[model samples]
Target: MSLHDPAQLMDERRRLEGLGLSVTRYGGAIGLIGLVLACLMGFIQENGMDRFFFVYLTNFIFFLSISLGALCFTGIQHVTRAGWSIVVRRLMELLAANVVLMAILFIPIIFGLHSLYHWTHAEAVAHDPILQHKAPYLNTAFFLFRAVIFFAVWIGLALFFLRKSTEQDESGDYKISIRLEKVSSWGLFLYAMTTTYASFDWLMSLDPHWYSTIYGVYFFAGSAVALFATLSALCIGLQKSGRLTRAITTEHYHDLGKFLFAFTIFWAYIAFSQYMLYWYANKPETTGWILRRQTAPMLWVSLSLIFCHFFLPFFGLLSRHIKRNKSLLFFWAIWMLVMHWVDIYWLVMPEYVHQYGEIGAAPFGLMDIFCLIGFGGLYAAGFAMWARGRSLIPMKDPRLAESLTFENA
Candidate 1:
């Protein structure tokens, strides 16, 4: 009955694979088709290509945060010697691997720098005193160099942890556990630094003239929320496919829901804190950023986020029954995912297109859907590939038995 029995664990994994493969394959195919259609739409629509380019770049940056957040989760599980999560950590590892795909997607962003980022243009920078001062740090060369370093650090950490975990799966050596613990302890620190800086470079810099000390933390909060929502959805979908039925229980769903709930609050707090501080100070520079968002149609989008992203989820997930109920949880998870996209859209689009009369639906074009589909498809494909031919759970973990028997107090 010991969960660490290699023979039994392998047998269970084989059984789960047979059940899960068809669903996973179907999902991946649908995702691929959606992406292709989106791309075509982008090309067909007038001025769509430019909009698509921006959407693509933004989604690419957003995926980078998700991928890196997954890396952070994987490292934390190892460092904490968390057994309950051992069953799910491999899923995270695979998601982390999508960081490579995200890095590849960054090419469009690099090429479209002039279009997506105003500060990237010499004419724009020269006219603005603030941008001119920031030119040294915000120039194309430094931007590219920082991006390369960010990916190098992220990919290095993901591969190292994944490699070590796979090696331990084969050898079943205790020493490998110790090594992972050591690596993840330091790796978490690096993750925090890298993700914060990446957020600053990719997102915060969109408004180069404006700055917030709390912007990085705000990004982290949103990233964690988005990632938790993704994990919950994935787990629920896998379970419905009749995989991980026994390995992952309602308790796991409950725990995931709690994290999602906590991060939702954190995201709201950071967002409000950032806004409140700027509003109270009433400084021209800080208020200018808010001014762009608070007027016209963008104002409605901001209000929608308050309701969809914070208020709705805040109360919707409060019930224990809802969190543990597979169907309800799945619905909420999908809702949160959509809201996160809107949140990002609100954050980046207003700044990029503020001159277009404050939102007015911001011209919901094919490019947005195409970029999302393309990036999401690639991410799903990478995850599926990583999940293939591996034990979904770390069966050899010393605490596997404890995890299987875990229950909420």
Candidate 2:
């Protein structure tokens, strides 16, 4: 803790002096191929751009959630001024920074807005009372305006913290930390508003007649948990590549595991709470959405989520011994990530399929995989490029010593 300990500080810096991260090499190729294939599949698909936009929306939210979750993670660290996460915070910063790229990626969704939301149809809005009632907020012009504002708020906050954090790594300015803390505190309220309304605009309005007050919070829960799994997997993979092998220790991974475990439960709680209240009230409008997921073949996916998303991880990650084990924890992290995808897929694909008087999983078909690969490849590549520009850890953070030497009791 002494300012006189120059040699000790230099040792820590040397450990993170080189981080081997190159996304453009292999990752760029994968992204290019996936997107091209997705485009080809889009053109080839039957009927309009409906199928293509539907696929895009599913994948768009999937990747966007992880980015926003990282934004939330960055905001939390800055606000709390937490010491334990300094070693791994840069990974999260890079993820949060991808919010810029996601906004650009969201352009296609903007062009295809009419394809995804029923309320955007003029004739349909004219005929349907519900759509008419919601028209003041759900009109295309206002929709695009909200989308732009949401991206601006998220991107601005994301860049500010990331920029300041990188600068502090160079200058070791203590004031930068204090400034980030203030920005992060104010930024949390902005994040909540943007994400909530954005979720309603993007996801909830898919079922035009359906409404749920907690849907945005539901989106937040899944997104945050997904980021935990992502960070855990990234750290393990980087360690395997001999990057940050010593810098990010098992203690950090254990905390990551704990978060993954905790939020898996939180996601389930929000999910069930939404369903339980809706089920009890028996409102035809809201209950229809849940029923579509609960009845027939769709119910199979719902049960699968209950087991995979909640129970499996719940019991599997319950032990402190399991949390501390690297390989076992990585396995569960992958499981939770897959389950999160399934969870979103269930939420989205059912409405798409119901248009044809059928409801189920992947019924809209395999373009889902293609778009996922496309966006996932692009998102990962952005993460790598961002990480390549800086130290793998926040090497000069005042709390770096605490994080590097962290222990879990």
Q: Highest TM-score, which number?
A: 2
Structure candidate 1, residue pairs in collision: none
Runs in model 1 with CA error above 4 Å?
A: 1-8, 14-47, 355-359
State the local distance difference test value for candidate 2.
0.82
Candidate 1 global CA lDDT score: 0.77
lDDT of each: 0.77, 0.82
Residue-wise C-alpha lDDT for candidate 1, range 1-409, written one tens digit per residue: 2243334454453234554465367656766676567667767877655566557656776676677768988898888888777767777887888787778777767776776677887888778998988888899999899889888888998988777777767777878878989999988998888888887888778788789989888888878888888899988877666666677778888888988888899999999999999999999988988887787667888898899999999999989899988888888888988888888777788776752232455556655775677667667766776667776666566666667766789
Number of colliding residue pairs in model 1: 0
- Which ten contiguous residues of candidate 2 have the minimum total lDDT? 1-10
Candidate 2 lDDT, 265-316, residue by residue in tens: 9999999999899889997777789878877788888999999999989999
lDDT of 1 at 378: 67
Worst 10 residues of 1 by lDDT: 1-10
TM-score of 1: 0.91
- What is the lDDT, from 0 to 100, of the residue 124 in candidate 1? 80
